[model samples]
Target: MHRSKGIVIGFWVVTALLCLQMGFTAYAQLSMPEVAEAIAQLGFPHYFRKELAWAKLLGVVLLLAPVPARLKEWAYAGFAYTLVSALIAHLAMGHGPESWIYAVVTGVLWGLSYFFWRRLQAPSVGLRPATA
Candidate 1:
């Protein structure tokens, strides 16, 4: 029971961290001039920034709300994909290896959150088999 509680707490902590990162990212994407300039420098259309910001906000909500499990799973998958793509984009833009840190850190957070979430859904490790 203690272990299960630990896992639940760990899951929420990691999920909160991921949500915080995504929330800030979405806000920056929507409102920051620097973010717009960076996206534009990457050859993306000006409208893509707003679109991605909205998508990220929605994804964060899906992860946090009492939504269906399948939807939550998609949110996790979407975040994973977004981070990986960001890493690739940075590399493609000729950014040095150091520029990958933000994406890498966020990716790890996402991974841990997803891992704990899956573990929480499994049968408790402390449970014992019933005897006849």
Candidate 2:
């Protein structure tokens, strides 16, 4: 089935935004001492900051590359899990909205990206909200 132009555009835009946010955060975590201190303050080990940053970079690559559908799905799921976990960590640490708001905004971007992705996949036998 041919994909709809609108859906294709929507997928790219939202996915780009999501990837950008993740990628920027990963960069910050890797390069900024402040980020490391913040992560430590949140009760996460120092190593976790590196691990999470690398994982985010990997997930961003997977989402942007023309990988298998299963891999793409896994990347999306990983991002969703990361966002939720971040929110929980912030809340558990009693951080104010400024600290946790990143997760909330990223989650919205993630949702839009996933939604458009699903619509792009709606071309199979049972899918309906897909392309033209």
TM-scores of the candidates are: 0.89, 0.91
TM-score of 1: 0.89
Checking candidate 2 for backbone clashes, the offending pairs are none
* Candidate 1 structure quality by residue, lDDT tens digits, 55-122: 89999999889998999999998898889988999989998868778889999999999999888777
What TM-score does candidate 2 reach? 0.91
Each prediction's RMSD to truth: 2.0, 4.2
**Among these predicted structures, which one has the highest TM-score?**
2
For 1-132, candidate 2 gives per-residue lDDT tens digits of: 778899899999989999999999999999999999999998998899999999999999999999998999999999999999999999998989999999999999999999989988876565456678
- How many pairs of residues collide in model 2? 0
